[model samples]
Target: MLRYGILFLSILFASSFDVSAAAISAIQSDLAVLRLCNASSPVSLQAVNSVLINRDMKSSETQTQDFKCFLLCLYVEYGWMDREGGFSLHHIKLTLESSKLPEYRIKKLIYSCTATEITDPCERAFNFTECFWSHSDKETSPEAEIPEKEVSDNQNGFYYIN
Candidate 1:
């Protein structure tokens, strides 16, 4: 479309802020995907608007089934969520890496919040967005130490050498 072409060409020029170019590209990409997903999902324009404006929609009463499905469509399009409701962590990490945040913080966020007991794709999408967003607001100190735990031979998908 002409809009995307214009947006794409605009990204070639530098912006005023340090991460403005990346931020702009990310935002533009999101908008394009959102519009495409919006067409296929049973969500309303109002629902999209509300969700975009309010980060607390997961807990809000406005989080309808349509809204959840819309979110799922977004994740699927972004390659963050697959057909089996599994998250492609590599894609997620790459997506987050686009942000201005440090690598450690992004990894920490993914590690702490990605695991869930939810089986439904729509529900999982909602949960993931809420989980990721909630923790993103709380700043974790880089100097903070994580308590070490002993690893078993077959724990968390890895075995100890010894």
Candidate 2:
């Protein structure tokens, strides 16, 4: 009985560690993506951190606008949004799918945040980001959710599995 109990405990601990490691790896991947997006403009992570420091603080519209623009710029830099002021839904879907995020959430976000008539890249980015921020909800944010699948390596490349 004692030996069995120890074996069960070890298995439980190992499983928990795997979950924790997967979560950490996901976070690291997210940060890496953000860094790649910010490579051109090079906004320091510290600046972004400062913006997130006081989520409850009442901020001016301009401050809000800045943050939104920053996020939009990252999306654009990532090639998820085109220079011609079009969003690549395919890319967004691919990314979210890989992350094990809900497809409905991505659809809803695109529906709510896209600027249908915008033609200029910068203006479109601004509009889209503004819309995104206005409709942003805690439950819908990718960072707020844990991935349902773990990313693993295979002969081909990386893949997610339950």
Candidate 3:
């Protein structure tokens, strides 16, 4: 079910944080709410898995877009982000708390990746992910930042991996 999938995702996220077992269990319980929401329609489980598994490595623009879209799909499905791509601070706080991440890190993420300006949910999500990863502390985070110098976009709005 969706609950299990979300739990799996929580585990994947928590694994990056080196969290306690209690925190992991709490995240699992918290992610149960995702089951009541819609599933990710635009992204498949395979796509999600691929992104999560290879997030730390170099990836093509298409792969990056897919990963960002997957994250956006989850946000929309969870109702944390509106269809128009507006971010809810309350929902973000709830999710971060559920994940048991440090308050400072959560605040930093919220500050850096607020998607209020973006009108399209998908585009907003993609931009948010890019910002999140770019601003992340590589030593403390599981996913490394994509080098800005190496990232270039084409006319089609897709980034090119150099």
Candidate 4:
């Protein structure tokens, strides 16, 4: 009975590890694709606005619907979202160590920093845009700490969008 219990525990541990790794991999892959898009085009606030207007994107749905908007904006502004999306283990660590940022705030930052034209302060689309350079504060990055083994085990070739 003791042996059986130990085996069960081991299996549980392995399964947990596997799940976490897969999660990390998916995150990593998404980052990679965003990075690729950013590289393809230097993102700017104007560029994002153009895309948003063209696509009619909005800040509804808790701003998740705005992720692609943020991505395009980031690409227009900084020319890359995440330093090549975990190209190297060191790069991943650097990203991990950097200050944590709310996903929404980061998106807003990309807009403020990259906004080329700010003629209409009266009709500003989103208020959060100020957070970009309003202060130098860095929030915790989205990449939460997961076991290294788990992150590695779930390496994915492509990032998925919901």
> Highest lDDT among the candidates is held by which one?
1
Best candidate per TM-score, number?
1
Which residue window of length 10 is worst by lDDT in model 3?
Answer: 144-153
Better candidate by TM-score, 2 or 4: 2
Over 3-122, each residue of candidate 3 has an lDDT whose tens digit, in order, gives 456667776898788898898776765454334322443444454444455543234432554555556666765655655566665677778788877666776677667733566567
lDDT tens digits by residue: candidate 2, 1-162:
323333454467556775677766665565566655455344444445444443322334324444445556667656567545567655666875776657667666655555356655556666665565555453565454433333343433322222
The C-alpha TM-scores of every prediction are: 0.66, 0.46, 0.50, 0.20
lDDT by residue (97-149, candidate 1, tens digit) is: 98877777777777665566687878888888878878887888886554333
**lDDT (Cα, 0-100) at 131 in candidate 2:** 63
Q: Given candidate 2, what's the lDDT at residue 126?
A: 62
Tell me the TM-score of model 1.
Answer: 0.66
Q: Which runs in model 1 stand beyond 4 Å of their true positions?
A: 1-32, 58-61, 143-162
Q: What is the lDDT of candidate 2?
A: 0.53
Per residue, candidate 4 scores C-alpha lDDT tens digits across 82-161 of 22221122332344336575544444344334333332221122222333324325554445442212122114321111
Question: What does the lDDT come to for candidate 3?
Answer: 0.57
- Candidate 4 — worst ten consecutive residues by lDDT sum? 153-162
- Measured on C-alpha atoms, candidate 4 has an lDDT of 0.37
lDDT of 2 at 147: 31
Task: Estimate every model's Cα lDDT from 0 to 1.
Answer: 0.67, 0.53, 0.57, 0.37
